[model samples]
Target: MNAPDRFELFLLQDGEKKITEKIFTGLSNTSDFILLKEDHTLGNLIAEHLKQAPHVLLAAYKIAHPNVPEVMIRVQTDGTITPRDALRQTCQTLVQMYFALGREFQKEFALRQFADQGDQGGAGNAGGQGGPY
Candidate 1:
């Protein structure tokens, strides 16, 4: 079958706003969140993180179709917390993880750069003579 014709729904243009809203479910402690202009990258990440939350009973996400750029994430939580709280906690955890990853990456990058500089014989090499170790 052919894809949907709504290109604007999938594409983000200048001055366009990103949308995220909660869809209340008939059952308590369960809700669906809609995230527009997102794809599997975010959906999978969120699902994985949500699954890690102790209070979350279920966490899943799907796209209606590949043509659609929106993700519908359904979360069911225990009575201890709401789905919104689980999602909020997931976001915070993800942000902290991201920062930690960046910090580790910077440290590794600096180490690699220092190693490379050392290999290049780092300054004070006159007349291309090898220095004594």
Candidate 2:
């Protein structure tokens, strides 16, 4: 599928109830969206992943003091990390943190596509012989 066809469903669950909303997949899937949302949910998700990286504490320091010059300086001033070490750790962490959700998204897309392809008069998932997922 091309970029335009990519989409995601965000499911919010509260106890037994589920609230679903659709979001387009694109730049919106990245950190910028998290920064835009007033809700802390997305920020928490990013923070959770970021916390796993060695130099994330330095990033957190930078976040806390946005006006600080040179993250490497701030990271070292507190003692522990060297400039080179922090850079290497940050890059390694980011590389390891890349999570591929496309396969799962495609599976969801396939199931939705399958549902749409089925006979409308029958119960959902009832008419199809089997889905390819």
Best by TM-score: 1
Q: What is the clash tally of candidate 1? A: 0
What would the TM-score be for candidate 2 when compared with the true structure?
0.29
Candidate 2, residues 53-124, lDDT tens digits: the string is 453343322222433211211222122544345534654654454332444556667876677767455556
Mind sharing the TM-score for model 1? Answer: 0.74
Worst 10-residue lDDT window for candidate 1 reads 124-133
| Least well predicted 10-residue stretch by lDDT in candidate 2 | 29-38
| Candidate 1 segments exceeding 4 Å error | 1-27, 120-133
Could you give candidate 1's per-residue lDDT for residues 97-121 as a string of tens digits?
Answer: 8887777777766776767677786
lDDT of prediction 1: 0.80
User: In candidate 2, which residue ranges exceed 4 Å CA deviation?
Assistant: 1-48, 54-58, 61-99, 121-133
My TM-score estimates for the predictions, one after another, are 0.74, 0.29
Supply the global lDDT for candidate 2: 0.36
Error of 1 at 98 (Å): 0.4
